[model samples]
Target: MQAWDDIINIAMIGTDKKQPDTISVPASLAEITTRIITGSEKNREEQFLQLASLLYNYQRCGISPLKKETAGTAAPVEEKKYCSTHAALALRDVLQDDNHSLLQYWLERCDSRTQIAPARFVPALLINGERNKKLRLLISSCVGKRGEWLSGFNTAWDFSAKQTQEEIWQTGSLEERQEVLQQTLVTDPLKAREWIRQTWQQEDAATKLVLLSILAPFADESDIDFLEGLSKEKSKKLQLFALESLRTIPGSPIVLMYESFLRSAVTIQKETSMLGFSKKNTLQCKLPDAVSEDLYKTGIDKLSSDKTWTDDEYVVFQVMQYVPPSFWEKTFQLSAEALLELFEKTDTGKKLLPALTKAAANFRDRNWANVIAQRRSVFQKELLPLLPLAPRDSYINHFFAKNINDVMDYAKETDEPWSMEMTRLILREAAKKPYPYVGFFQKVIAQIPVAVSTELSSYPVSEDQYSRSLWSGMSEEISRTLAIKNQINNAFTI
Candidate 1:
C-alpha cells in the first residue's frame, strides 16, 4: 500500500532528525509498515486484515524499533545498536488529528486479503468507523498475549481489570484459575453470583466462600439460604461468613429461623430519658396476639439482662433489619394505651415507637391510626417542634418515609438530602424506577460538589496525547450517555 511505503520512507527520512540510526515512524504508519512487512500475500481479505491490524497497532500502540547503545569500552568494537522505536510515535501525531482521514483508504485497500492489495485509496468506499466491531477484532487478536500488549499500552495508560477478567473468563478453562474469577467476583456482584451458581457444586468450601465474597455488593433476601447451606460445613470461618452474610439481606427467610432463638435469649433492658421518669420503671414492648405466637417466642429477652452474648453491631443489626415491621403492629394490638404508657416511660420506648409506626404501615393496620389520634394533642404540642433539630431527626424521617407515604410527601416539601434519598427509595419501590431523585440529580449535575467535579472534567485529555486516546474518549462518552439514560428512567419511576 502507498500509505505503508510513505510510512517507511518517512521513518527513513526522519532517522537523522530523530536520532542516528533511529528510524522513528509516526503512530499509524509504523503499524502500516509492520503489516506490509509481515502480511500474507495470498488473498485480498487476509492482506486487508493485516493492514487493519497494522493501522490499529500504529494508532493504538505505536511502533517498536528503538536503538539502545551499549556502554563504551573505547576498544573500537562495533557499537551495540538497538532498533529505533521513534517511527512508531511520530505516526501517533498524525492518527490523533481529527481531519487526517486514512481509515477509508485503509479499509478499501485491505477489504479482502488479495494476491495484490487494491491500489485506490478508494474515494467511493462505503466504510464507516465502528468501535464495537474494531474492539471485537482487537480482542480476538490480543486475547492470550495481554501482558505483551500491556507493555506497549502500559497499565497507567490503559488499566482495565474488568476487561482483563473478561478475556480470561471467555478463554480460560480452569475453574481453579482463580485470579480472573476472583477479581470478577470481587468487582461485580451479579456476575460473581452467576459464576458461583454456574460452578457451585464443583467448588470446595474455600472456593464457595471466595465466590460468596461477591455477594457483598448488595445483600438481599435470597442470599440467606446460600449462606445457611454453608453453615453445615466443618470450616468455622465459612459457617461464620454464611451467618454474617444473612444479616445483610433484609427480607430473608433466615430471620424466621433465628427469631425464636433471639426472643428466648434476649431481654428488654430498662432505659430512661431526659424527659423525666414515668409511672413504669421498665417499658413493655407489647405484641399483637397471634394464632401462631411461636415466631415471637425467641429467647433474646431472657438473656437481655446477661452480658455474655455481646457481638458486633452487624450481628444484632442483621436480625433487627430483617425482623418484619408487621411484628410491631402485632405488639400494638395487645394494648394501644399500654404502648403509649410505655412510650412515656423510657427512652427505648420512644425509639421503638417509630419502628412500630413503620410496622403498622407494613401490616396496614388501623390501630396505628387510633394510637396517633389519641396522642395527637401532646405529639403536636411537644414532639413535632423538637423533631427537625433533634439528634434522631434523620432516623425518624427515614423510618416514617419508609413506612408511610404521607410522611414522604412532607419530606419532599422540605427538599433535604435525606428526603431526596427517601424519595429515590420510594420511586424505586413503588414505580419500579431505577433512581427517583430527579431534582437531586439535576441539582448535583448543575453544580457538582468540588470533591468529585475535577476528575469528571479532565477525562477527555488522554486521547489528544495518544491516537489511542481518541478511541478511549469515544468509549467513555458512550458509557456516560448510557448512565444518563438509566438515571432518567429512575427519575420517571420516582
Candidate 2:
C-alpha cells in the first residue's frame, strides 16, 4: 500500500519530475517491486509503469476478507401464498424482456390475487423496484415477508425494509427519499412542503430539481408562495420549473397574471358580411412593445429563439402556453371548435396554435383536446390521450389509411388497446406496407387485445421478400407477447 501510494504521488508529479526509486513497499512486496524496477534496462517512465503495475496487483491480491460471522435469524414464515407456476414463468419472461408495462400488470395481478412473487424471483423484482421508485410500493406489497427479509442483508434494497417515513427521508437513497416525499405529499402535503422547505438550501441542484418536480402534481395554493419564491431563484432551470409548476395550479398568481395579460393582448374581432347575413370572427393579437419587468419575473424571455416569430410573438406564445385554453374560450365567449377556426384564420395563429395545443394538453382540457383532434394536425397526436375513447379510436381509424406512421405514433403514445376494428385496420395496413410498421410492432404489441391474437394468422402476407421477412418476425413476436399476457391473465383467475 505504501508503494502504491508512492507510485501515485510520483505519477501525479510526473515521471519526468520524480523517479520511481522513492517507492516504499512492504517487506513482502519489496522483492517483487525491486525486480520490477531493475528487472530490465528502462527509462524513468518505464520504471514507474512497472512499479505501478506491480504494486497495484500486490494490493488487489493481498486484500483481506472480513472475519466471517454467523448468519442472522431466519426469515419469518410467510402467510401469503406463492403465485402460480404459470404466473411465475410469465413474470420471468416479462422480466427478461424488460417490459415495464407488462411487469406493472404482473405486479398488479400478483398483489390483487393475494399472492407473492416466487422466492427465486423476489431478488430480481426487488432490484427492479430499487431502480424504478414508482414500483417500490407495489413490489414491496407483492414480494412478501421473505423479500423483506432478503432486503435486510442488502442496503440497496432498503426500500423493502421496514423503516419510518422520517427515517427514510433522512437516511434513504435519493430514489427512496423521493418515494417517501411522494407518499407524504399524498397524506400530509403541508408536512412534505415543510420538509422540502427545511432542506431547500442544503440540497444539491439535481436533488432540488427532482424534489421540486414531485411538488408539481400536488401543487396548490399552499405551494404558490414557495414556488413563486423558487421562480426568482438564481438558477434559470429551477426558475422555469417553478414557474411551470405554478402554471399547473389554476388560481396561482402567476397563471392569473398570464391570463390577465392575454385577455388584453389577445382578442376576437367580429365582422359582418356585406349582406349583413353572415358574421365572422378573427383572432386579434396585440403584441407588447417591450417585455415588462413583471413578465420577466415570471420566467418569460424577451428574445425569440424561434426564427419564424418576432420577440413579441414569441413572448405571447410563451405566455399563452401557461394560460389554460379554457381561459381563451371563456374570455372570448366561444366554443373550442369556433376558437380553433378563428386561430386558423389569423397571421399569428401558426405560432399560437401550438401554444394553445400545449396548454390544452397541459391543463388536460378535454373540450380543447376534442376540437384539436378534429383538425388531424400535428397537435392531434399530442392530445390523442385526452380525447374520449370513441373519438380517439375514430380519429385513428379515419387517418390510418392516409398516414399509417402517424396512426402508429398515436397508438404508441396513448398506449391503449386498440378497438377490434382498429386492430383489423392496423393489420390491413401492415399487410400492405409491412416495412414501416415493423419497427413499432413490438412497442404496440401489448396494446393488442388477446382476442385479436387469433386473427394474426389470417392477415395477408407481403409479397416483397424484405417486407415478408419483417412481417413474419413482427407477427410472431405479437403472438408470443399476447400468449404470455393471456397466460398471465388466466393464471390470476380465481
Error of 2 at 492 (Å): 1.6
What 10-residue stretch in candidate 2 is worst by lDDT? Answer: 65-74
- Model 1, runs deviating above 4 Å: 1-192, 201-210, 248-253, 258-282, 285-322, 330-344, 347-448, 451-494
Clashes of each: 49, 0
TM-score: which candidate is best? Answer: 2
Please state the error at residue 466 of candidate 2 in Å.
Answer: 4.0
TM-score of 1: 0.31
Task: Locate the minimum summed-lDDT window of 10 residues in model 1.
Answer: 117-126
- Tens digits of per-residue lDDT, candidate 1, 1-494, equal 34445445545665334221113445535555555545456354454445545644555554566543532323222122211233212222212321112221222222222211111211111111122222222222222232223223332313212245555554443442354555555577577566666667777777667656645434465566666677677877777677666644554555565454335432444456667574334643332233233333422232233344333222332334345444433533536666556555665455445544443333334544345444531221122222333322444444553344444444444423333334334433322221233333322221122233223333333223443444344334433433433332232233
The prediction achieving the highest lDDT against the true structure is 2
**Candidate-wise lDDT, in order:** 0.39, 0.79
